[model samples]
Target chain A: MNNLAVDLPGLQLKNPIMPASGCFGFGREYSEFYDLSKLGAIMMKAATGSERFGNATPRVAETASGMLNAIGLQNPGVESIIETEVSYLANYELPIIANIAGSSIEEYEKVAAAFNETDHVHALELNISCPNVKEGGIQFGTDPKMAANVTERVKKASNLPVYVKLSPNVSDIVAMATAVEAAGADGLSMINTLTGMQIHLPSKRPLLANQTGGLSGAAIKPVAIRMIYEVKQQVSIPIIGMGGITTSEDVLEFLLAGASAVAVGTANFQNPFICPELIDALPHTLKKYGFNTVQDAIGKGITV
Target chain B: MKKETMRIKSTKRIALDTVEMVLENNYMSQTAVPGQFLHLLVSGHTLRRPISIADVNKTEHTITILFKMLGSGTHDLASYQVGMTIDALGPSGNGFQLHNDNQSTILLIGGGIGVPPLYYLGKTLAQLDMHIISVLGFQTSKSVFYEEKFRALGETYIVTDDGSYGDQGFVTDVLHSVESFDRYYSCGPVPMLQAVTASLKDKPGYISLEERMGCGVGACFACVIPTDDAGGYKKICKDGPVFDAQEVSL
Candidate 1:
């Protein structure tokens, strides 16, 4: 009886693998590669109060075992997303988590409230940690008070569970986690990409058009595990860990570090079938580690 | 849009720093169309490099890709030998839309590495019995390739930045010399594409674009170009690597 299922605040996942927001893009494109129902949930691309063109061209640059992107939350406003993207995803049997982002608290509330119209969206991943945006993203994420304030407002606006995505750029990951948790965040999704840049030698300038972008890949895994371990001890809410997850072993490491489930990010670009692949491999890996189920493995690696 | 582990049937240098590698994959060779690209995963690299399909041979069960050693990833790809297998996501992107209507005469404008897909396009058009003409531009004679292949199809001209080749100038410089063309297709750097578009503003044309891509799929909006209408943008990976001449702003 190998059980891969894990229950989070608002998500009843069949397995512990889901595609991270921004990387999955509403589940339309990847739906071509594999069945959407095979995964536990789908974390959609960040949606705002209005449409955003995001950053200019040369938006992504490759680094060692990782990549940098300043996509700046490019999305077709929440209204359009609800009218089309969300409704389209409703056809899937799995849970749909809507990731909401904005330039202000009011915009966050508006975008959060907008998801109430869709019956298919089971949760809301509050994206206060998006490193690419200028005004709202990291500004809210880095400051404890601001992170709590946005969490509180969004919690009031939406019926779905709110999961605050923490940024690794902050000095104290636990402080940001506790603040959001106290403000009523149902769970935590850490860590959003670490702010980094790559310099192109020939051009004698930054590689990404936005100059600096969030770095995510194998290079950020250890940091993610450390943060999840630290924050899990300080906060009581479940943690949906992501950052440099590419293999089933990475998923188990995250679970042991106290993540309830895991999200696949940059690895989706490397292999579109990564989610299902991880889902299939997780049970065997868990058993090899002496765990009967995914839930049994959570926090096993953390010390009091 | 199939993912397959394609084996390299042969690998050789075609021009200066460019390498031509033919990969044997039955599904890809049979399904790939002109201007479609292969998002190949090179060992020791994070992101998969998107290389356009240079040509396809259904009978041989192989698809050819020509790439220049641009950086560490491509340089590593150039090192791969025959019989090696590479993971590929392919026939990706919206390829060129071919029509055998009254637009029988076609002009192909290519610059450097962008010349590969045009070769595939020229080959496909030639099979349709369409009259083809190609104007290829390179940095020098050493960088020029496929001149004879294009000439076998129809009238072909080679232009180089340095006066070591056919004509000393840009492709736009020789545009007026070609008698006439009912339609044109181009793939090159932004400046060259812009110049070609401006010179042939009234002509029906399609241009392939290049951008730094994340997931060579529509999932990531990394490779987007602004639409001409100024309303929104289109993804270069999904909406097109190929677009109508007047569709996108350079």
Candidate 2:
């Protein structure tokens, strides 16, 4: 009860836990397990300009410590979300971050503009990093100018807070992160899925229906943490970190990497009660580790 | 968003990649009819496994599920033995519906592992005073099972592609022999579903489709199929795993 709140720019979330998009589809399922209102916020599945059928079969392929998905952003389109899912999500009474994607910058603006009219939607998390689809994936994320352009467009068009979702498949995230920040992005979330592949060795063909996919799960934790630390140094904006978060211990790691908040992803598939358990375990770990607040633990171990 | 229709009472590994699990919960059992499926939360898998219930004993407080190890999750379930626990969320998707009071001939056709769910459906229909014609197809005789059990339900026929069993071809040939029946029920591969749809275009039939679903509920829009009956796409998880013959576009 002694102040566990984590603020992200203009928005105030009661806690630092939010479900990553695609992992938590509007919190309807999670509601069956626990009171979703207890969490800080929710990231609805990545929305797009039109309804997507997603990739073909075997969209998800498991690796050593993670899984890759080429789901191709399957959704009912943005207008449907505003017309359907948003009302149910708004019931959570916390910030509702809309994770959106598109084939072009104009499409991003269209998706963002739809949410701008809704008072309950706290922010627009532009997913420039998703590796699943054929259009505007790494194309918008890897290049500083492209990243800046999309961020600028959404910021210019959206009345809500804009958080640019960064991709990990880049060589220097610092450049991309810096570019988005300068483009008027309110906050930043990193790093979206890492592009990887799984080979069906017997057939000697790529396992995923789409040859390459975005890798996520416990495997990418280290790489994600490293990205958070590097970006924390270059950008002063709030950082919402997500990649392979499974437990409160992992949450503590993200906090220590200079993330203002953290998101729970792939772990939901492994355990439906992951968030509740982590919520129960988090504060205790913070005090035991000599930190008064979860925020104080942010970037505690990193020198750079 | 399928709820935990039941909870694990006992779980055991009976084979290399096979798990013999029993779940006990009435929310699922009381309304749990045959040919319906249950999605399993396999510990290490990225998602749940949509397994057809092998058998369910409501009075004894048990539902049986057999999971074949295909990947990490099933491999994890395969490692468990007696008294182990797992989560179950289902009795999901529409099961086969038979006219309870009608005295009619019932044709039950299934293929390979698809034969499991029909065992229960055939058993349920046998309760009524009716004639049941069962035709099962498998790749080989070794893979064929429950023939005697299904025979107890009514008349049973077996077919294997290798000719190591009853008929030396697809089971559809034997099923076609019936020519006409009051009703037909089937569950199997897409081609088999397509075949059933094509063959029974002029007859009364019910077909269940199995699609890789996301939420196992109507929400995700992941398991959508063209509806010949409804016009728009219908969600297989909620609207059906079972569909009215004329409703599904092959």
After superposing candidate 2, which stretches have Cα over 4 Å from the reference? A201-204, B1-31, B69-76, B98-101, B128-130, B211-239, B245-250
Where is model 1 more than 4 Å wrong at Cα?
none
User: Could you tell me which residue pairs clash in candidate 2?
Assistant: A256-A299
User: In DockQ terms, which candidate is top?
Assistant: 1
Question: Worst ten-residue run, lDDT, model 1 chain A?
Answer: A1-10
Taking the tens digit of each residue's C-alpha lDDT, what string does model 1 give over B179-199? 888899999999999999999
Task: For residue B188, give model 1's deviation from the true position in Å.
Answer: 0.8
Q: Show the lowest summed lDDT stretch of 10 residues, model 2 chain B.
A: B213-222
| Model 2 lDDT, full chain set | 0.79
Fnat of candidate 2 is 0.14
Best by lDDT: 1
Q: After superposition, how far is residue B226 of candidate 2 from its true place, in Å?
A: 5.2
